[model samples]
Target chain A: MLIEAAHKPHERLGAYLKDEMAAVNALISQRMASKNAPRIPEVTAHLVDAGGKRLRPMLTLAAAKLCGYRGPYHIHLAATVEFIHTATLLHDDVVDESGQRRGRPTANLLWDNKSSVLVGDYLFSRSFQLMVETGNLRVLDILANASATIAEGEVLQLTAAQDLATDEAIYLQVVRGKTAALFSAATEVGGVIAGAGEAQVKALFGYGDALGVSFQIVDDLLDFTGGDAIGKNIGDDFRERKLTLPLIKAIAKADAEERAFWTRTIEKGRQQDGDLDHALALMHQHGALEDTRADAMVWADKAKAALAVLPDDPIRDMLHDIADYVVARIS
Target chain B: MLIEAAHKPHERLGAYLKDEMAAVNALISQRMASKNAPRIPEVTAHLVDAGGKRLRPMLTLAAAKLCGYRGPYHIHLAATVEFIHTATLLHDDVVDESGQRRGRPTANLLWDNKSSVLVGDYLFSRSFQLMVETGNLRVLDILANASATIAEGEVLQLTAAQDLATDEAIYLQVVRGKTAALFSAATEVGGVIAGAGEAQVKALFGYGDALGVSFQIVDDLLDFTGGDAIGKNIGDDFRERKLTLPLIKAIAKADAEERAFWTRTIEKGRQQDGDLDHALALMHQHGALEDTRADAMVWADKAKAALAVLPDDPIRDMLHDIADYVVARIS
Candidate 1:
């Protein structure tokens, strides 16, 4: 349906990629139908069917197709990626003790923590069983590595939370581990499972890694940018004492007054009603948001450049467009 | 060591196997050493050094040696198995909200729930990375399945707790998933990594499964029969409403009043002072403990028979002695 919108002026790549993503979503839903635990389907469907972007799974499916896969197993691979993603979200909600996700009530809040944890474990098991049925040990290796990396990332993020010494290097490591690893793995496995050559597989992973970095940087940037329609409020990262790119930059550029304010608000994690506005003003005054956006654009450009080695196809064009779409919102 | 005290009567098998199992203990301690995350080495040493029969890891090492594995990776595998077991204990303590393990404060109570959960996750990741370094896909597959089965078993046990209708069938499934799966995977992968034949692998798995089942049954029996020096007061499983072998057998043999007692104590999960004594008396009067001991002996015998299929060696003798050791108290 959004393909029609893609033809319009200033239309985004998501509009063009809607149908393929919907196929991935449908596949995910079908595979998530559990027989033993009735609660599993209910809880999993609640998160899976929630109207968030199926970006990761779509990336997996798109990568496989771009590598000239004609088999139906890509559907299973996409579903597996989505299941692992959804399961992580369920556990994350419990771990973060957060009430909202993707602008909706989190699973732990809606159901209970026990259900979130147990159901998350169940989905993980189900995901493994699904991958095992593929009989592709390489895929198993990739996905299991991704699962372990994702869990480690969450643990790192937990440890890094509210710690002011969390510099750019550790921050990048946290982001790469938490977000980029799965993205890279998803696309890389897609290429591997589709029987792509080593070079193309490497390119796909590079593209995915760059795209994921761009996506996360843009997301982090939006927290300070104050875009109401995008569900990002002003200084959200600062309010949470999350040392995003802009904040780290701003901290480096802090004047005496700014340093004092940041030390009290960000470092001490003590914020007031006007603290968000103050933080946003500091970020703008220091040009940190602009710097973060520029960094994101650099990654987006790298993602597009990685496609130079691949053979031309509509999927390649779409991937390039998707990379641009990642940074488009920040601009 | 208890080997010296318990082996006084059986001078032959006891002292020799004691030295062998001591090697297993030394291997476990050596492998559990960590350079990162000081808490890891600390929390792990707390449990690994806690006095218990190193039966499971010994089974793994013995199986590997019996299959002529000269490689040092078996030590890593043995430690990996123990780490997984310890990690699960940490998470299980939090989930069960238990206060005591080995008559000492649980990690949850001692360290905190957060430490328990995150440390459990850390050990899990470490184990995954360790197995990956093994570069044996079959070993990875076996261990991954064991992990899922272990989690599923824990969930199943959580659901089955205090549910009186949880009969021997579901009980056995839980036991298989929780205990036998890991035990079998430990021994099975030992044979696998050693490049043993399929028949040998299957026999090792069978031996471990029977050994684990018998060991768990004896543990449950000890909860009812063993005195405080063993070390808790009797009927710990009854107090916890765990529908173990003894309880399952007693539920079957129970009459109307006995059924009512179980319904109130286990199904309703209500217990008063002296209820443990009453439960033990019922277990005696109904011959439930006797039946559970018989079932455990049958499994021990089956384990010995499974070992009979393997080639005769000192490890084989130790395997047989381990099986005998499992039910030695009950017999």
Candidate 2:
């Protein structure tokens, strides 16, 4: 466990696919350039250079390599995935009205919401252009559907985020839309581009879907347990009135008094200074945090189990380890 | 000319392509719906049902019919174009912080910016899905590039909207990005999907591009001369401090004293009650409005000339007449 902790799954996968990742980065840089609107590039570069792990695109590369196929289009697909992710982040910051991201002032905060919105649209169109260049209709279908699902999920979250009645089912749907849709699409496109068979492609999709669910679950968990290492301040989801998994679980089992407290603080937005601590205490009383952590591990295990059908390869092994690592954060 | 004037080009074209346009409209209505997020359809239905002429989609239908298309995909392409146009308008309203559009309250005003932005994204993704269903990569490329160009043009307009240094060249670029790129794509994709010859396709592209330019020039001109007939208040552009073509021309010829007035009213956005009238007087002093009118005519003529390569079909004739009608609004 210590050795596994020391050598992270993403770092291992990144080292293995270093050259392909580099090409994806180069493409992202080249394509994000605007001949006329310098603000587009300025805003894009601020977020792009904020040092995200590039985890989504690596999933694309790893899936393609594991399929034992070689193609130039994977780089295009990988870059397309990254651009879509970045564009979503830009718009998400605006939607969330976030002031900080990745330990830096968000583009919306630094430049303005207008720049973030327009630049995000530019990046989205840019992603479509890159994907269309591959001339793969299937790839276009997956990514385009994923984009729509992501948007739909976001709209769902907008309406459901503050509603305490937003149950575990709605939470999973939002998680799938906002996070897992892109992950599954990224991996599925790689296999489709590499001409992988139906079984292998399904496995890749299943792996990505489960992994993404685990990743988001862990992210929501970290908003409670994440120290400064996570960059984001703790209790963000709670303060924002986001009814994530833990809160949903807690609310499900709350007594009449506890339900009133949640209704006042969350639904009514009448939060006080110690509301977070009280919320945490309620979560502890219900064992919601531990239960949420257990759920994330179940998802990670599903992700790993899904990969068993794929061929045995170093890249495949890295993907398996990635699933484990995602839940490891919570553990 | 009087009879031709009584029967406007879009109405005639709409009559000619009535069934196709109806199908396109139905498809649009069906696709804008959300299974989970009811807000997506609500906001979209508001703007989609608004009385705008649906001119861009009509261009696609007209182009396809002129190119002798008999396939079912033109309806898909037409709906796709409308979706793209509608999405841009949604985002544009948010960017401009606009309250009204097409004489009605904007989606952003009725709903929130968050709803507008997310719903706009949903429409864009829906448009892409529609276009990809055609399996024509060229159409995808054209529409995707146009989308990128539209976004770039918008960002350029944002930065240049208040700057006095924005010239005629930049204004044209902004106009092309904001208006013509989609027009050209709408028509170009129709021809591409119809398997039109290169010359015919180029002619279609040229016609749409010129028509879009003329359309926007007239829109800008009407802001000053349109009175209440144009639905929007006169001087709205001046109030917004948008440096449209006429104002750009007038500012170019400003004397030292007039330059200060222009700077204070436009560049610095310090407008008093009589400022719009003063700006109009300045434009008159320099013949800016007349010159702008002349420019619109030039573009209309260019649009007519671009149709020379196409067969002399009635749809082609209506397209040529539509170009004239766009400019006729100002004349």
- Best-performing candidate as measured by DockQ: 2
Model 2 agreement with the true structure over A113-159: per-residue lDDT tens digits: 78888999999999999999999999999998999999999999999
Give candidate 1's error at residue A10 in angstroms: 16
| DockQ of model 1 vs. true complex | 0.25
State fnat for each of the candidate structures. Answer: 0.10, 0.70
**lDDT, candidate 1, B177-278, per-residue tens:** 779988998899889989999899999999988988887888888888883344376666788899998888888888999999999999887788887778
Worst 10 residues of 1 chain B by lDDT: B1-10
Candidate 1 stretches with Cα past 4 Å from truth are A1-39, A70-73, A110-112, A129-141, A226-240, A255-273, B1-54, B71-76, B101-105, B109-115, B226-236, B254-261
User: What is the CAPRI rating of model 2's predicted complex?
Assistant: high
lDDT of 1 at B33: 54
Please give the TM-score that candidate 1 achieves against the real structure.
0.85
Q: What is the interface RMSD of each candidate, in Å?
A: 3.4, 0.6
What does candidate 2 score on TM?
0.98
